[model samples]
Target: MTQLSLHSPVGELTISEEDGVIVSVDWGWSPFQEENELLLRAKKMLDDYFDGEEVEFDLPLKPHGTEFQKNVWKIMSEIPYGQILTYGEISDRLNSHARAVGLACGANPIPIIIPCHRVMGKNGKLTGFSGGEGISTKRYLLELEDTFNNLDDNLSLPF
Candidate 1:
């Protein structure tokens, strides 16, 4: 896998690619770095996104996962920027369960580009995030995009 690191508001992020397709976007920096046209473009899009530029990523994403997880990721990818979706909504769309959908969201390899942070818990509750500073990272992304429709700033999560 080829990895490239970029600095964002949340912290350092490392984007991984394989076979010319983006496979993951992870927190922190990678020990190794390789520059390429694809990785460079992915970095640029992420920069725009963090800068609140409403960038629609045109890069090819191939997050490594199972069929169900892939389906979940696909649904998440379609969620427009500055929009939110609940686990229940995704479960209903997939004919699955909310817990399952949440699990898939947690397992998402690519975070921002796939928009997993846009997903909320029951009644727009903030939940666990696997990247950066957990729910805080999710909150920052949501706040950055101004997509907190049902979420309030007065949760116990300490913003």
Candidate 2:
């Protein structure tokens, strides 16, 4: 696995690529770093994304997870930037339980790129994020996307 680290507003992130497909993005720096075309491209995309530009990642991703997790990740990936979806919403679509969907979301190999932060609790309630600084990290990403402000019924951020 080849990994590269970049400093972002949220924190330092290490993106890993295997066989030219991105496999995971982890919090903190990776002690070992390697240079490759794919890693370089992923870094650039991350840079632009953190710069507040609306960028859609066009790189290949191969998140390692179960079929159910893969399906959950796929649905999360399709969530429009700055948009939100409740765990219950996704579970409804998958005919699975909300807790199961939340579990799959928590296991997502790639966080920001897969957009798992877009998933929330029912009624726009903020929930745990297995990446970065937990719920605070989720709050940061949602605020960065300005999603909290757009929530209907004036659903305030749960914090």
Candidate 3:
């Protein structure tokens, strides 16, 4: 696996690649000193995203997960940049339960790239996030995407 770390506005992110495909994007820096074309591209895309450029990541990803989890993540990847989806909505699409969908989202190896942060709770409420700073990071990501426009009027942000 090749790992490259880059600092972003949110925090330091370490992207891991295996066989030229992104495997995971973890919070914080990794000491693994390696870089490849894919890693550099991923870093540039992430940089552009953080710069509010509305960049779409077009990299190959190979996240390891169960069949169900992969299905959920695939659905997540289709979520638009500035849109949000509820667990219930995803469950309805997959014919699964909300809790199961939430679990699948939590298990996502790649967070921002796979966009698990775009998933919220019912009524547009904030939910758990596995990333650093938890829901705060999730909120930051949502704000970065300007997804608050899609949030329910009843949903309030800490800003």
Best by TM-score: 2
lDDT string for model 3 (20-122, tens) is 8999999899988697899999999999999998978888999999999999999999998999989999999999999999999999999899999999887
lDDT of 1: 0.89
What lDDT would each prediction earn against the true structure? 0.89, 0.92, 0.91
Per-residue lDDT of candidate 1, residues 3-47 (tens digit): 999999999999999999999998888999999999999999999
The sequence of per-residue lDDT tens digits that candidate 2 reaches over residues 81-151 is 89999999999999999999999999998999999999999888899999888999999888888887778
TM-score of each: 0.92, 0.96, 0.94
Q: What is the lDDT of residue 154 in candidate 3?
A: 83
Q: Rank the candidates by lDDT, best first.
A: 2, 3, 1
Looking at model 2, residue 132 earns an lDDT score of 84
Candidate 2, poorest ten consecutive residues by summed lDDT: 150-159
